[model samples]
Target: MSDANNQTKAAPKHSAMHIAVGLLARRDYSRQQIQLKLQQKQYDADEIETTLDHCQQSGYLDDARFAALLLKSHISKGHGVNKIRQSMQQKGLSRALIEQVLLDSECDWFEVAKLKAQKKYGEAVPLDHPTRAKCIRYLMGQGFDYEQANYALAVEVD
Candidate 1:
């Protein structure tokens, strides 16, 4: 009797499909995030895999689409290529997919850097070489290429 009870306790308490649906209903998650969360919940690996496959087939989960959403939100908030790439990679996106998205984006990355720097500097920009250099550094830290950073810093946004 105790053995049978123990076996029942070890079994999954929730259906795989229910967990998948609950997660997706919250927000878009990368496959990796979904998998990690599912694993944490002690879902059966095979059952989870089957659920993931079904979710993909039914369009409940999509890495490519998740990548696009990440790109758009990051761009809107002024994230640079490297930052966005790293963010997506942490969520299990492939480098090739990241590169393709950046390449296809029409957003002016240089302009983005400049705008971001200008906002951070407020009004003491052109007169302050040190501040300008600091801005350059900050923008670089955001993953802008040197050329892009230079152009962004050189031109004052009026």
Candidate 2:
């Protein structure tokens, strides 16, 4: 019947809180990320706000925790501080919060660069100028600064 077909086609209604909890149940999400997802789902503004506040108060949504987790993941992947910071920013974390998390992490950018270089180029430093430059560029592309990249290649800069 047309009525049965229409009922079947109608989407099930879900409260913003329900949707948010469902999302968080799978993985942690930044407050802003949740807001965007709820907005995309056409949730009412007030409903979205209420849901976000409840999630935050319930310790389900935390930007800091999200940022920290992202940082740890990036570090494990051999990403430099700059790349990690950029990633957190892209995830909608506040600049202050990103800086605080990075500061608290106490990660050594130089060590990460060196390890990445070692993994990519082996233990011996590249002897040829072009090869060395390529290694430096590669490190920089991975988010290391010039100084860090040079350090990773064991190049001394005056």
Candidate 3:
């Protein structure tokens, strides 16, 4: 019948709040990330805004908390501040939030670079020019600045 066919073709309707909550149940999401997801689901702008407000009001969504957790996770994985900032930006976190979380973090980037270098290369600093350059490039790729990369290459690993 046409009625049965129409019913089958119709997508199951879910409120924006319900969809957002379902997503949050799986993992933490930034407000912007949630907005993008809702937009992708074809939610109206007003409905998306209301859902976002409610989620924030209920403490189910907190950008600050998400930023902190993201920073901590990146640091634990031996990522540098630059890499962490890039990741946060890609995740739609605001610059101010990213800076605040990074500022609040107690990670010693120098030490992290050193450890990462040590873990990858070994206790000894690279001596040959080409090998040293390679090591510096590797550290830089991992988001360490030139100074930090040089320090990682020059310092004696203990």
Model 1 scores a TM of 0.85
TM-scores, in order shown?
0.85, 0.93, 0.93
Query: For model 1, how does the per-residue alpha-carbon lDDT over 29-134 read when each residue is reduced to its tens digit?
Result: 8777888888898888998898899888989999888999999999887778888888999999888888888888888998888777668765445547786677
* lDDT of predicted model 2: 0.92
Residue ranges of candidate 1 with Cα displaced over 4 Å: 1-12, 127-129, 156-158
For all candidates in order, the CA lDDT equals 0.83, 0.92, 0.90
What lDDT score is found at residue 44 in candidate 3? 97
Q: Better model by lDDT, 2 or 3?
A: 2
User: What is the per-residue lDDT of model 3 for residues 1-158, given as tens digits with 9 covering 90 to 100?
Assistant: 99999999999989999999999988899999999999999999999999999999999999998998898788778888888999999999999989989888978899999989999998888799999999988888888888888888785546
Tens-digit lDDT track for model 2 on 5-66? Answer: 99999999899999999999999988999999999999999999999999999999989889
Task: Point to the candidate with the largest lDDT.
Answer: 2
Name every residue pair that clashes in candidate 2. Answer: none
Shift in Å, residue 129, candidate 2: 1.4
What's the CA error at residue 32 for candidate 2, in Å? 0.9
Q: What TM-score does structure 2 among the candidates reach?
A: 0.93
The residue pairs that clash in candidate 3, if any, are none
